[model samples]
Target: MPSSPPNPQLAKRYISYTVDDIARLFGIHRHTVREWIKRGLPVIDKQRPLLVQGADLAEFLRKRRDARKQSCAPGQLFCLRCRVPREPAGWQVVYRPLTATQGTLNGLCGTCSARMCRRVSLAKLTAAAGNLAITTTQAGEHIDECPTPIVNRDFKEG
Candidate 1:
Protein backbone atom coordinates (compact mmCIF):
# COMPACT_ATOMS: atom_id res chain seq x y z
CA MET A 1 0.00 0.00 0.00
CA PRO A 2 1.15 3.56 -0.63
CA SER A 3 2.56 5.36 2.37
CA SER A 4 0.71 8.50 1.33
CA PRO A 5 -2.37 9.02 -0.78
CA PRO A 6 -2.11 10.30 -4.35
CA ASN A 7 -1.64 14.05 -4.60
CA PRO A 8 -4.80 15.85 -5.69
CA GLN A 9 -2.64 18.85 -6.51
CA LEU A 10 -1.38 16.95 -9.57
CA ALA A 11 -4.84 17.03 -11.13
CA LYS A 12 -5.79 19.83 -13.48
CA ARG A 13 -9.11 21.18 -12.21
CA TYR A 14 -10.29 22.23 -15.64
CA ILE A 15 -9.91 18.77 -17.20
CA SER A 16 -12.32 15.85 -17.50
CA TYR A 17 -11.15 12.26 -16.99
CA THR A 18 -12.18 8.79 -18.11
CA VAL A 19 -11.77 5.79 -15.80
CA ASP A 20 -8.65 4.64 -17.62
CA ASP A 21 -7.22 8.16 -17.63
CA ILE A 22 -7.72 8.52 -13.87
CA ALA A 23 -6.13 5.12 -13.23
CA ARG A 24 -3.12 6.08 -15.35
CA LEU A 25 -2.83 9.54 -13.82
CA PHE A 26 -3.01 8.20 -10.25
CA GLY A 27 -1.03 5.01 -10.93
CA ILE A 28 -3.87 2.81 -9.76
CA HIS A 29 -5.71 -0.06 -11.44
CA ARG A 30 -8.60 0.86 -13.71
CA HIS A 31 -10.90 -1.22 -11.48
CA THR A 32 -9.96 0.93 -8.50
CA VAL A 33 -11.09 4.02 -10.39
CA ARG A 34 -14.34 2.26 -11.22
CA GLU A 35 -14.77 1.35 -7.55
CA TRP A 36 -14.36 4.99 -6.67
CA ILE A 37 -17.33 5.81 -8.86
CA LYS A 38 -19.47 3.22 -7.09
CA ARG A 39 -18.20 4.56 -3.75
CA GLY A 40 -19.62 8.03 -4.46
CA LEU A 41 -17.24 9.58 -6.95
CA PRO A 42 -19.55 11.66 -9.15
CA VAL A 43 -19.71 11.14 -12.89
CA ILE A 44 -20.76 13.23 -15.87
CA ASP A 45 -23.85 11.13 -16.76
CA LYS A 46 -25.01 7.69 -17.81
CA GLN A 47 -23.07 7.90 -21.10
CA ARG A 48 -20.93 5.52 -23.19
CA PRO A 49 -17.55 6.61 -21.74
CA LEU A 50 -17.84 7.52 -18.06
CA LEU A 51 -16.30 10.91 -17.35
CA VAL A 52 -15.19 12.38 -14.01
CA GLN A 53 -14.20 15.99 -13.72
CA GLY A 54 -10.63 16.55 -12.54
CA ALA A 55 -11.91 18.89 -9.85
CA ASP A 56 -14.33 16.26 -8.56
CA LEU A 57 -11.72 13.51 -8.68
CA ALA A 58 -9.23 15.63 -6.80
CA GLU A 59 -11.81 16.60 -4.22
CA PHE A 60 -12.91 13.00 -3.83
CA LEU A 61 -9.38 11.78 -3.32
CA ARG A 62 -8.69 14.57 -0.87
CA LYS A 63 -11.78 13.74 1.14
CA ARG A 64 -11.01 10.03 1.06
CA ARG A 65 -7.47 10.68 2.30
CA ASP A 66 -8.76 12.98 5.02
CA ALA A 67 -11.27 10.34 6.13
CA ARG A 68 -8.45 7.87 6.81
CA LYS A 69 -6.51 10.27 9.06
CA GLN A 70 -6.04 9.07 12.62
CA SER A 71 -4.89 11.80 14.94
CA CYS A 72 -3.34 10.90 18.30
CA ALA A 73 -4.68 12.64 21.34
CA PRO A 74 -2.75 13.31 24.56
CA GLY A 75 -0.64 10.37 25.83
CA GLN A 76 -1.49 8.41 22.72
CA LEU A 77 0.53 6.93 19.90
CA PHE A 78 -0.74 6.10 16.46
CA CYS A 79 -0.36 2.35 15.90
CA LEU A 80 0.74 1.77 12.35
CA ARG A 81 -0.49 -1.80 12.31
CA CYS A 82 -3.88 -0.99 13.79
CA ARG A 83 -4.34 2.29 11.95
CA VAL A 84 -5.67 3.97 15.06
CA PRO A 85 -4.46 5.96 18.06
CA ARG A 86 -3.71 3.90 21.16
CA GLU A 87 -2.38 4.59 24.61
CA PRO A 88 0.86 2.95 25.63
CA ALA A 89 0.68 -0.28 27.62
CA GLY A 90 1.22 -0.26 31.39
CA TRP A 91 1.07 3.52 31.38
CA GLN A 92 4.82 3.62 30.78
CA VAL A 93 6.61 5.53 28.02
CA VAL A 94 10.23 6.15 27.05
CA TYR A 95 11.28 9.63 26.08
CA ARG A 96 14.28 9.46 23.78
CA PRO A 97 15.80 12.85 23.09
CA LEU A 98 16.59 13.72 19.47
CA THR A 99 17.76 17.27 20.17
CA ALA A 100 17.87 19.86 22.91
CA THR A 101 14.14 20.51 22.87
CA GLN A 102 12.59 17.77 20.71
CA GLY A 103 12.35 14.05 21.34
CA THR A 104 10.16 11.01 20.66
CA LEU A 105 7.83 9.16 23.01
CA ASN A 106 7.85 5.42 22.49
CA GLY A 107 5.36 2.96 23.89
CA LEU A 108 3.53 -0.30 23.26
CA CYS A 109 -0.04 -0.46 22.07
CA GLY A 110 -2.30 -1.71 24.85
CA THR A 111 -4.49 -3.61 22.42
CA CYS A 112 -1.95 -4.97 19.92
CA SER A 113 1.28 -4.68 21.93
CA ALA A 114 2.94 -3.20 18.85
CA ARG A 115 5.70 -0.63 19.25
CA MET A 116 4.55 2.90 18.68
CA CYS A 117 6.34 6.24 18.76
CA ARG A 118 5.30 9.88 18.64
CA ARG A 119 7.38 13.02 18.32
CA VAL A 120 7.12 15.39 21.27
CA SER A 121 8.70 18.56 22.54
CA LEU A 122 10.48 18.75 25.86
CA ALA A 123 8.51 21.84 26.82
CA LYS A 124 5.16 20.16 26.18
CA LEU A 125 6.18 16.69 27.34
CA THR A 126 4.00 16.89 30.42
CA ALA A 127 0.86 17.67 28.49
CA ALA A 128 1.60 15.07 25.84
CA ALA A 129 2.55 12.38 28.34
CA GLY A 130 -0.51 12.96 30.48
CA ASN A 131 -0.65 10.34 33.25
CA LEU A 132 1.95 8.01 31.79
CA ALA A 133 5.21 7.45 33.71
CA ILE A 134 8.06 8.82 31.61
CA THR A 135 11.60 7.43 31.48
CA THR A 136 13.93 9.95 29.89
CA THR A 137 16.91 8.55 28.01
CA GLN A 138 19.59 10.08 25.77
CA ALA A 139 20.14 8.86 22.24
CA GLY A 140 23.53 7.26 21.64
CA GLU A 141 26.29 9.45 20.25
CA HIS A 142 27.71 8.81 16.77
CA ILE A 143 30.22 5.93 16.64
CA ASP A 144 32.97 7.98 14.98
CA GLU A 145 32.65 10.67 17.68
CA CYS A 146 33.61 8.20 20.43
CA PRO A 147 36.82 9.12 22.27
CA THR A 148 38.30 5.63 21.79
CA PRO A 149 36.61 3.33 19.30
CA ILE A 150 36.90 -0.48 19.65
CA VAL A 151 38.36 -0.94 16.13
CA ASN A 152 40.99 1.77 16.69
CA ARG A 153 41.80 0.38 20.16
CA ASP A 154 42.44 -3.13 18.70
CA PHE A 155 44.71 -1.87 15.90
CA LYS A 156 48.30 -0.84 16.85
CA GLU A 157 49.99 2.16 15.15
CA GLY A 158 53.45 1.66 13.65
Candidate 2:
Protein backbone atom coordinates (compact mmCIF):
# COMPACT_ATOMS: atom_id res chain seq x y z
CA MET A 1 0.00 0.00 0.00
CA PRO A 2 1.19 3.53 -0.72
CA SER A 3 2.02 5.71 2.24
CA SER A 4 -0.56 8.36 3.10
CA PRO A 5 0.35 11.95 2.39
CA PRO A 6 1.21 13.92 5.51
CA ASN A 7 -1.46 16.54 5.06
CA PRO A 8 -3.49 17.53 8.09
CA GLN A 9 -5.22 20.42 6.36
CA LEU A 10 -6.97 18.18 3.85
CA ALA A 11 -8.69 16.26 6.63
CA LYS A 12 -10.13 19.43 8.13
CA ARG A 13 -12.17 20.50 5.10
CA TYR A 14 -15.08 18.14 5.72
CA ILE A 15 -17.37 17.70 8.72
CA SER A 16 -18.81 14.36 7.63
CA TYR A 17 -18.93 12.08 4.60
CA THR A 18 -20.82 9.23 3.04
CA VAL A 19 -19.07 6.18 1.58
CA ASP A 20 -19.50 7.57 -1.90
CA ASP A 21 -18.18 10.96 -0.85
CA ILE A 22 -15.07 9.42 0.69
CA ALA A 23 -14.50 7.24 -2.37
CA ARG A 24 -14.78 10.21 -4.69
CA LEU A 25 -12.50 12.39 -2.57
CA PHE A 26 -9.81 9.73 -2.30
CA GLY A 27 -10.24 8.45 -5.87
CA ILE A 28 -10.95 4.96 -4.61
CA HIS A 29 -13.86 2.58 -5.01
CA ARG A 30 -16.89 2.85 -2.72
CA HIS A 31 -16.28 -0.78 -1.83
CA THR A 32 -12.88 0.21 -0.43
CA VAL A 33 -14.52 2.70 1.89
CA ARG A 34 -16.91 -0.02 3.00
CA GLU A 35 -13.94 -2.27 3.62
CA TRP A 36 -12.35 0.42 5.77
CA ILE A 37 -15.60 0.55 7.74
CA LYS A 38 -15.32 -3.20 8.29
CA ARG A 39 -11.75 -2.68 9.51
CA GLY A 40 -12.82 -0.34 12.36
CA LEU A 41 -13.48 2.97 10.66
CA PRO A 42 -15.97 4.72 12.91
CA VAL A 43 -19.38 5.55 11.50
CA ILE A 44 -22.73 6.94 12.59
CA ASP A 45 -24.98 4.00 11.70
CA LYS A 46 -28.21 5.35 13.19
CA GLN A 47 -29.37 6.79 9.84
CA ARG A 48 -29.79 5.06 6.48
CA PRO A 49 -26.86 6.59 4.59
CA LEU A 50 -24.32 5.83 7.38
CA LEU A 51 -22.37 8.96 8.03
CA VAL A 52 -18.63 8.99 8.76
CA GLN A 53 -17.52 11.93 10.87
CA GLY A 54 -14.52 13.81 9.55
CA ALA A 55 -12.82 13.95 12.94
CA ASP A 56 -13.22 10.20 13.43
CA LEU A 57 -11.86 9.41 10.00
CA ALA A 58 -8.92 11.71 10.50
CA GLU A 59 -8.04 10.08 13.81
CA PHE A 60 -8.37 6.60 12.33
CA LEU A 61 -6.15 7.39 9.37
CA ARG A 62 -3.57 9.10 11.57
CA LYS A 63 -3.34 6.08 13.83
CA ARG A 64 -3.04 3.74 10.85
CA ARG A 65 -0.22 5.83 9.40
CA ASP A 66 1.56 6.04 12.72
CA ALA A 67 1.41 2.27 13.13
CA ARG A 68 3.04 1.81 9.75
CA LYS A 69 5.79 4.26 10.73
CA GLN A 70 6.79 2.25 13.80
CA SER A 71 10.55 1.73 14.24
CA CYS A 72 12.31 -1.01 16.18
CA ALA A 73 14.02 -0.23 19.48
CA PRO A 74 17.80 -0.45 19.83
CA GLY A 75 17.81 -4.18 20.55
CA GLN A 76 14.98 -5.27 18.29
CA LEU A 77 14.22 -5.90 14.62
CA PHE A 78 10.88 -6.19 12.92
CA CYS A 79 10.04 -9.78 12.05
CA LEU A 80 8.21 -9.77 8.72
CA ARG A 81 6.92 -13.31 9.10
CA CYS A 82 5.72 -12.76 12.69
CA ARG A 83 4.49 -9.24 11.88
CA VAL A 84 5.89 -7.87 15.15
CA PRO A 85 9.06 -6.39 16.64
CA ARG A 86 11.33 -9.03 18.11
CA GLU A 87 14.77 -9.33 19.65
CA PRO A 88 17.33 -11.53 17.96
CA ALA A 89 17.54 -14.99 19.42
CA GLY A 90 20.53 -15.29 21.83
CA TRP A 91 21.70 -11.77 20.92
CA GLN A 92 23.12 -13.14 17.69
CA VAL A 93 22.84 -10.10 15.46
CA VAL A 94 24.74 -9.37 12.24
CA TYR A 95 25.38 -5.81 11.07
CA ARG A 96 26.16 -5.03 7.45
CA PRO A 97 27.04 -1.45 6.57
CA LEU A 98 25.01 0.06 3.73
CA THR A 99 26.67 3.46 3.84
CA ALA A 100 28.86 5.58 6.08
CA THR A 101 25.97 6.37 8.40
CA GLN A 102 23.39 3.64 7.69
CA GLY A 103 23.32 -0.16 7.85
CA THR A 104 21.11 -3.22 8.19
CA LEU A 105 20.76 -5.36 11.27
CA ASN A 106 20.00 -8.99 10.46
CA GLY A 107 18.97 -11.72 12.83
CA LEU A 108 16.50 -14.54 13.41
CA CYS A 109 13.19 -14.12 15.21
CA GLY A 110 13.37 -15.63 18.67
CA THR A 111 9.98 -17.28 18.35
CA CYS A 112 9.45 -18.18 14.68
CA SER A 113 13.06 -18.51 13.47
CA ALA A 114 12.22 -16.28 10.50
CA ARG A 115 14.87 -13.92 9.14
CA MET A 116 14.40 -10.47 10.66
CA CYS A 117 16.02 -7.25 9.47
CA ARG A 118 15.89 -3.54 10.26
CA ARG A 119 17.63 -0.51 8.82
CA VAL A 120 19.50 1.43 11.50
CA SER A 121 21.82 4.37 11.79
CA LEU A 122 25.48 3.38 12.06
CA ALA A 123 26.07 5.61 15.10
CA LYS A 124 23.15 4.14 17.03
CA LEU A 125 24.24 0.63 16.06
CA THR A 126 27.76 1.27 17.24
CA ALA A 127 26.43 2.34 20.64
CA ALA A 128 24.23 -0.74 20.82
CA ALA A 129 27.11 -3.04 19.84
CA GLY A 130 28.90 -2.24 23.09
CA ASN A 131 26.36 -4.37 24.98
CA LEU A 132 25.19 -6.96 22.44
CA ALA A 133 27.07 -9.76 20.66
CA ILE A 134 26.91 -8.44 17.08
CA THR A 135 29.00 -9.46 14.11
CA THR A 136 29.96 -6.57 11.85
CA THR A 137 30.45 -7.06 8.11
CA GLN A 138 30.97 -4.95 5.01
CA ALA A 139 28.11 -3.81 2.79
CA GLY A 140 26.39 -6.59 0.77
CA GLU A 141 28.24 -9.34 2.67
CA HIS A 142 26.00 -12.33 3.43
CA ILE A 143 26.48 -14.13 6.76
CA ASP A 144 25.97 -17.88 6.61
CA GLU A 145 25.07 -18.41 10.26
CA CYS A 146 22.53 -20.97 11.43
CA PRO A 147 19.52 -19.90 13.46
CA THR A 148 20.11 -19.84 17.17
CA PRO A 149 17.95 -21.97 19.49
CA ILE A 150 15.11 -20.14 21.14
CA VAL A 151 16.02 -19.07 24.68
CA ASN A 152 12.81 -17.45 25.85
CA ARG A 153 10.96 -20.07 27.84
CA ASP A 154 7.65 -18.27 27.42
CA PHE A 155 7.56 -19.11 23.74
CA LYS A 156 5.46 -22.17 22.94
CA GLU A 157 5.89 -24.65 20.08
CA GLY A 158 3.14 -24.72 17.48
Name the best candidate (by TM-score): 1
Model 1 C-alpha lDDT per residue in residues 20-115, reported as the tens digit of each score: 898778677677777679778899997959999999989987876664575678888765445466898998988888879987787888999977
Clashes in model 1: which pairs? none
- lDDT (C-alpha) at residue 31 in model 1: 70
lDDT of 2 at 128: 52
* Best model per lDDT: 1
By summed lDDT, the worst window of 10 consecutive residues in model 1 runs over: 143-152
**What lDDT score belongs to each candidate, Candidate 1 first?**
0.73, 0.67
Runs in model 1 deviating more than 4 A are 1-4, 7-23, 27-68, 141-158
lDDT (Cα) of model 2:
0.67
User: TM-score for every candidate vs. truth?
Assistant: 0.52, 0.49
